[model samples]
Target: MAHEGKADEQLFQLLANLLHQVESLTNQEEVELRTKIEALGLEVTKVPSKSLKQLDELEIAKELDKLSEKLDNVDEMISSAMAADPQVQSLLSDTADIWMPVITASADERRNFTPSVGENSETEANCES
Candidate 1:
């Protein structure tokens, strides 16, 4: 009935909102990571060309590796959020699966009962008097 449809709409809206939130979080993380990488690149570019010692360069590279690991963690978190978000959608999907057929059959029955304007309405009016 109307109630079930309303419930479905609410569920769909909730799931959609959650998905959008996760997407926004991912975008924010990407922007933040890009900024970090650009800043690090600028810093590395400032290093003196004369003192190109392997050990110092390796240490700087290790710092970049740490940043990379942090990015990986952010990615994992986003993946986890996405994975969990599906549970809400799955429930809504289940509701649709069980109720959609019944709603369709009821709608069909209602359509069948509706009289066409020309013949049936006139016949029914004649019978009523």
Candidate 2:
């Protein structure tokens, strides 16, 4: 009977120690996860019951409709302004002439210009020196 009681006591102590270790590990993991989440610029918070509300779908739809109409009006105004501006018209008409040669020259130079890997490192070292 004495030996059985001693065995039970030892088993309980071992279980208690294991439980404590598991709880410590869990707490450490929770702290690390919270720190990582905070570092990511995200808010980790609980919402209050009073602050939580269902979305008003009808209101959202109405607001989106109003926004769409406003955007269309703005687009029309921009088109009218562009049509009225001679400089804008000239730029639109001459876009290829103004941009094509410069773009083509850059592309041709890039195709021809292959620098050795060591060349870049040497240039960087020289600049640092």
Candidate 3:
């Protein structure tokens, strides 16, 4: 039982690290998306072409879907980490209070900007028991 507890601790730490990485990657992707949008906006303002502009819009939509998937994975990691310990569950609850709205807003903003976008197909699966 003692060894099992130690293993659980290690697992929790691993989950935390993984969640942090996912958060970082998601943030980086958001920045990249914003940059692409700005660049495309500039192009549209300067030399607006339907084909190029439409392709850029499609790319942005795809990137947004990818971002949504990444955020879902981060949420799943947090949920799994919290399940490992009561303390972690409480901590995650607090963190979610701060983070969940921002992630949801980000997704909503993307959808609002791109009305002709496709829905995301990323589903979170539980692998840890």
Best-matching candidate per TM-score: 3
Writing each residue's lDDT as its tens digit, candidate 2 over 65-108 gives 98679658645754764586564344334333322332244434
Q: Is candidate 1 or candidate 3 better by TM-score?
A: 3
True-structure RMSD, every candidate: 23.4, 29.2, 18.4
What are the runs in model 3 whose C-alpha is more than 4 Å off? 1-55, 95-129
Pick the lDDT winner.
Answer: 1
True-structure Cα RMSD, model 2: 29.2
Residue-by-residue lDDT tens digits, candidate 3, 1-129: 343333333334434443444446445333443444355334323533466444587898997898679668656755775685565565445444333433345433423432112211111112121
Q: Rank the candidates by lDDT, best first.
A: 1, 3, 2
Error of 1 at 67 (Å): 0.4
Give each model's whole-structure lDDT: 0.48, 0.43, 0.44
In angstroms, give how far residue 117 of model 1 lies from its true place. Answer: 53
How close to the true structure is residue 41 of candidate 3, measured as C-alpha lDDT?
A: 37
User: Which residue window of length 10 is worst by lDDT in model 1?
Assistant: 107-116
Q: By TM-score, highest first, what's the ranking?
A: 3, 2, 1
TM-score of each: 0.27, 0.28, 0.34
